[model samples]
Target: MNLPELLYALALQHVPNLGDSTARKLIRHCGSAEAVFREKKQNLLKLNGIGKTRIANLQHTAHLKAAEEELKFIEKNGIGVAYFRDQDYPEKLKHCFDGPLLLFYRGNINLQKKKLISIVGTRNITGHGAAFCEELIAGLAPLDPVIVSGFAYGVDITAQRAAVKHGLQTVGCLAHGLNQIYPKAHRKYMAGIEENGGFFTDFWSTDKFDRNNFLKRNRIIAGLSEATIVIESAEKGGSLVTADLANSYNREVFAVPGRPGDIYSKGCNDLIKSQNAHVLTSAADLVYILNWELPSTERAVQKQLFVSLEPEEEIIAEYLQNMGKAELDLIALNCKYPTFKAASVLLNMELKGLIRPLPGKLFELV
Candidate 1:
């Protein structure tokens, strides 16, 4: 977008009641943000869902002035800007109904990766949670998946630091503006994070820091990824909110289970029990559920041809090979195994790269 268009888009974003969805509606009807301002009120009122109250603040000159100042700050700081409709915007986030109208970013970040997962959890992370967060990232390193997090304390920082250590690109979704970093203690890690990945936010430099901002920020963390993983969470927390948002967006959600009596395990356990999230015991679970296949070269090096399988696995494999593709229960019944036992065997075979799972509970040889 050019200077005038960017200024107008920013001004549209500044209007109080004109949310991202409404702004998009106006922009599409009028052809552009600049054109939206030039459009007459009567014609604008003819459109659906555009009420007087929503556009009441559209004519305010103060918005333009604010946008100009923000544009100056963006130019001065060399920050990157992505309009919602632009090709440069995060593809997954663009599908979100309430994604920001504009996103400001810093560092060498790339949103085009095929496999992106968000890892979120409680601020008061337990030692087991922290260890799991690191181990999970390390295990996922071979896939070169992008790690995204809230950039706050506990699980978020642990995941990002692990991503950096594993030489994987990681994105930090911030609650505040690009001009500042929250929890000042994390300032030291910024350079390392920016070295490979970077930060993303929609809040302007002048926006106030508020607790509600974190909730709003949660949407971006969820929207940017193909899946959201909760390493740990208490009964009530922001990570659960992110998980809900991910589910709302029709994306996959996974949670690491803990003992029944543990306080931090309550949220994850509830999600699994309620079937809102899949049980994530290791990276293999994610790899299997998402059906992510390694590159041919990597597979050649990692998987041995004619490798031996357990007697039961060999039975399941022979059945799938002959059947082409079979549903879970059919395979179990034909092979004389219980449904649950057959499902577990299928998962292990998938992790071993021996067979693959299909949608609708179907399985087949690789």
Candidate 2:
């Protein structure tokens, strides 16, 4: 089997306490990943912070049979591996201090785009919010831009699925290595992503999923993409972390607004209200602000032939638009769902980020 540079990069990756930054430093001083492997323990420990413990731990490179097994698993699946020192590593992400030393990609999507955006939100979403997500995805659909996100739940899935449905490349940035899909439910879909062109992660199969690894994964999501989009975040967690990192990297941050009282919407509205994000009401809003150059095919398909909404959906959308705002109960009556079912639908829509909820279950069409 033909192995890539990252196969060896995984050697350094398997070493404890020897991160990308330190690895890069070692490579800069010593030259090449192979040299680091060939060096004696005393020589490795001579470098700054290359403590005795780190060197001793790294000597375990001799036990690469496990790493080899990990590589075999991914290779068996025909997945691709990328390393920072290789020409295929993303140019934009290479400069980041703690960027990944290697990535395991399974999809056919384009990591390089004139503009890339990340979409993420809560696992629990609203139908109203989902509608908004659909609209946003539909609006942005024509642009042919690469969409990047963690392959978790809610907004992330929505954005990736929508992008693929619209014939755009979507890259799923994974927290764990390509060894397995975390949620497991999305395996079939993730396989479809690989078929259509979305890549996976960098770690070896044996690198059991870890919490800190997820945090490290976020930087790559932010670094690889050109901008970040928060569809529906609660006031805390992963989506917020992505937004913060994107801003730190000076990438554009866009947030859809939510209602005053809706818990899910609070994060997005707050980000905009706090000036961490530019407010985006529609794809048009984003296109205009960014002066985006839309793909020709997408522009041709922009006109809505029929209202994509169902009869009751149109009524609810119209009702929300006319009332300027109404609580979930009032909207529920309009949509034929019991309050509970209606709420579920609304959460899905909210994840899509369609309408913002107000203080008393009130929702206003965005």
Candidate 3:
């Protein structure tokens, strides 16, 4: 974007108490960020959710001055900015209701790859958790998925380092502004991370470093990926919050189950018991659930000759044969079965080699 337009957008973003969702609504209503400033207060209040308090600072000159200063910092630092409305914004994040209005990134990061997986866990990662995290990334290396995580001490660093070791691109979402790195010890790894994939953040250069910022940063980690995996977490942590955010965004969430009574495993077990996340034992589980490509031998579609199916399975098979592919809900509706029952029948059919599961909860005849 040009200087004038970007400045206006940044000013809109800087408006106090105005969030991304509300900002987007105003921008859409006004047609442009520049237009939002020029729009009359009476007109803006007409839109739902645009309360007096939210837009109270719309006319404040301080926001524009702050935007100009931020713009200068961005230019001087050679940072790349992705406007929410632009084509270059992360595609998956675009679907989120509360995604950032603008994303600032640095390094050789690329978003064209469709396979984005987020890995998050406790800062006090256990040995087993670290092993699983590394093994999972190593197993998934062949798919060339972009691994994403907060560049924190434990599980996050383990996953990102493994991704680098495996020659995969990895992105670090920062809770603070890109101008500074938290847990200063992590600074050493920044160069390697930027060499392949880089850092992403929405915080301005002047934003304060606060513990509360991590909660807001969690949303970006959850929003950027097709799935978020919790390697290990206590009963409560930022990683669990990220899992919840991913579920809220309708993205897949996976948790690695640990032994019973294990403090760190409690969170994962709870998530699975509540049916909020899928139990992830290995990378293969993620691959199958996401419908990523398998090895050629495993991917070969061999029809099971004279395959036998139960009555419900037969009904589903016929539906898929006619429809080519059908989602679980549709299969249940057309086959006169409850959704859970349909899922069970489909699982049997899959084991029988009569059908297969696909991404987006779709199923098809083998």
Candidate 4:
């Protein structure tokens, strides 16, 4: 990882009142993350938009603790993780305006190897939506591109599991630390994915599950993918949130038509009608849109790794994979376990050297 991106990433986490524009100003003046941390308040004021509050809010401690915590969690889980500066970080995400400062990961898949397309839909999915997801995934499976999703119960899980079943690498973006898999039951396939595909997340290990995280998580899912496909969404559903983010990022967003009287169909219909999303009726539409090629055996193998972790072990691995580090509580939230139990597992795992303990109560995959 480069010093500039690393420092900027860490520093940005602590920089309050530092909107995108202010952040750019700080970066421009400091020339690098290391330089920014080295500068005094007066020096920061020279930047065009920086103010006293934002400067005061630029405490490196929070960022450092968060970064180190993330690293610790990952080390403990035995999963591989990467930040923006890491060579393995996916290229599609790096250019996004609000791309994550860091990304935790797991599995044997190559982040740099495959092209990405995100598929998303409602948590309360309809039959038509489910059909759309299955058919689309099966169609795209032969092409061998990486499928990206939020790992939410509906279309996201369907797309990811479908890709896995078809022997394609699928990346599921999470709203929480990788310490545990969300929705719990999905761990079976998530473990399967780690052996082949992978997972990614941006939050620190200490952050608890909250409403805001999903909104933030969606951006990366959209930004990381070359394009996004909406299988189904209500008029105001989470899937559309991803579509809007994809559009704001200037990425393509697609929606499938639903039958009339379906409440879940309203979102898709409105998007198509408003011309917010492209009407995608088939995998061919994606193929034509993205110009993807079918993957050879060599390419597919390069995208994923066979897993050795047990189902529960992989749950912890997923947490570390997403945030690169985590605390007991965060792991519990993701895994749906009590914090005390998560601690016991962490202790056992740490003893095995699958993960390493960090200062300030964090653990990361080794």
Candidate 5:
């Protein structure tokens, strides 16, 4: 959009309590943000869901002044802006009802035909959870998917770092404005992430930093991806909120299952029990469920590797290889392993890409 149009849109976005959905309605009805400002109050009131209270600040001079200042910041910092109606806006996010009217970002981030996966979890990440987050990214690296996260501590940072290590794009969604970085300790990662994938936010440079802002930003993280994965979450946390947002968007939500008694695992276990999220034991489960196409070269290379299997996993794989495809119980019986033990081994084999699970609890070599 032109500078004049952006100024008007930003001002409209600056109006207090004027939500994105409502803003979109106004823009659609008025033909443009500039037109919305010129529209008569009586005409705007005629639109459904528009009320005096909601548009009370619509004509405020301060909003336009703030927008002017923010525009200066955008110009000075070389920030990229994505208007909701524009082609450059994130395709997945545009479908969300409450998506940001204006999305500001910085870096060489590219989403064209890219596979977007979001990984979220507790800021106080456990060692096991961190390992799993990294391993999951490593496993999915061959497909060259773009990793999306909140850029917070724990699972978010772990996933992004793994993406960088694997030479994949990683976008960090920020809670605050682009003027500064939160958790100041992460300032070091700015250059590297910007060099590849960068940061995204709807907040302006002048917006106050508040805790509630973090909750609001969760929608962006959830909406920008094809699927959102929860590495580990407590019974109540932001990651759970993100999962809920993803579900609301009708996107796939996956949670890493933890032991029933573990504190961090309770949220994931409950999500699985309630059927709110798919059980994410391995990256293979995500790939299979999403039906993402794997590269022929990577599949060929994976089949050639035969290392890193435990004794039990090797036994299950051998049984499946010989039988072609055998029921879980039959494999357990033939391998002299307990049913539960055999199931665990099969999961490990799935993680290693050695075998795949079929219908009716059957197993077959991948």
Candidate 6:
């Protein structure tokens, strides 16, 4: 977007009562944000969901003034701006009904043709949770998926650091703005994170750091990814909220199960019990559920090369190859192996790229 269009979009975003969806509606109706300002109040009111009060709010001069100042900040800092209607806007996020109309970002972030997943959990992470989060990212390194999180403490930082360690891009969706980093201590990790990915937020530099900002920021974390994974969450926490948001968007949600009595495990356990999220045991589960497969050429070459598998894995693989496709229990029963053992073998084969998993617990030789 040009300077004038950006200015109008910023001004429209500055309107207090006019939310992202309504602003988008008005922009679509008026052809442009610049045109929306020139539209008659009576005509804007005629649009469904736009009230007289909202039109009156749009008439305020203060919004434009604030937007002008924000534009100056963008120009001075070399910050990147993405308008919702532009091709550069996040494609997955575009599907979100309440996604930000404009996003301001800083860093060398790229999402094109990249697998994206958001990992979120409680700020007070447990040792097991941290280990699981790190291992999950490391295991997923082969897929080179983009890791997104809030850039907060505990699970968020753990996941991002693991992403950087694995040479994967990681995006930190901040609750505030690029002007500052929350938790203050995480400022040290910023350089490494920006080297591959960077921070994103819709809040302006001048916006205050409020507790409520995190809830609004959670949507971006959930919306930016193809799936949202909860490493660990308490019964009531922001991570659970993000999971809910991902489900609302009709995207996949995964949760790491904990012992029934564990405090941090309650939320994830609840989500799984309620069928709101899939049981996430390892990176293989995500790859399976998302149907992410290696290139057909690569699979064909691997299959022809006689790649080695464990004796048990070979038994399951041989069954799958002959049977076409089979579910977990069926494969175990036909192979005369225990169901738990068969599940583990399938996951290993998936990680090795020797087999592909389908929906409904089905597996087939790649």
Question: Total clashes, candidate 6?
Answer: 0
lDDT against the true structure, each candidate: 0.88, 0.72, 0.88, 0.73, 0.88, 0.90
lDDT order, best first, reads 6, 1, 3, 5, 4, 2
| Candidate 3 displacement at residue 242 in angstroms | 0.3
Residue 96 of model 2, lDDT score: 71
Residue range 1-366, candidate 6, lDDT tens digits:
999999999999999988999999999999999999999988998998999889999999999999999999999999999999989899999999999999999999999998999999999999889877876776677678999999999899999999999999999999997888898999999999999999999999999999999999999999999999999999999999999999999999999999999999999999999999999877767877898975454444455467777898778877987899998889878999645456666766766777887878888988
User: How high a TM-score does candidate 1 get?
Assistant: 0.84
Candidate 1 lDDT by residue in tens digits, 1-366: 788889999999888877888998899899998999999988998988888886668888999999999999999999999998899999999999998889899999876755899999998899888877876776677788999999999999999999999999999999999989998999999999999999999999999999999999999999999999999998999999999999999999999999999999999999999999999866767877898876655455433678779898899988987899998879989999745456656755665677776878787887
Residues 77-126, candidate 3: write the lDDT tens digits: 99999999898899999999999999999999888955999999999999
Global lDDT of model 5: 0.88
TM-score of each: 0.84, 0.76, 0.81, 0.73, 0.86, 0.86
Model 2 Cα shift for residue 247 (angstroms): 1.6
Error of 6 at 351 (Å): 5.5
Across residues 194-282, which tens digit of lDDT does each residue of candidate 4 receive? 87878888765667889888898988888988788888788897788889989988888888877668888889899999999887766
Candidate 5's C-alpha runs over 4 A off are: 296-366
For model 6, name the residue pairs that clash: none
**Better model by TM-score, 5 or 6?**
5
Task: Show where candidate 2 strays beyond 4 Å.
Answer: 1-7, 40-46, 61-63, 295-366
Model 6 Cα shift for residue 325 (angstroms): 16
Ranking by TM-score: 5, 6, 1, 3, 2, 4
Model 1 deviation from native, Cα RMSD in Å: 6.4
Instruction: Give the best candidate by lDDT.
Output: 6
Clashes of 1: 0
Highest TM-score, which number? Answer: 5
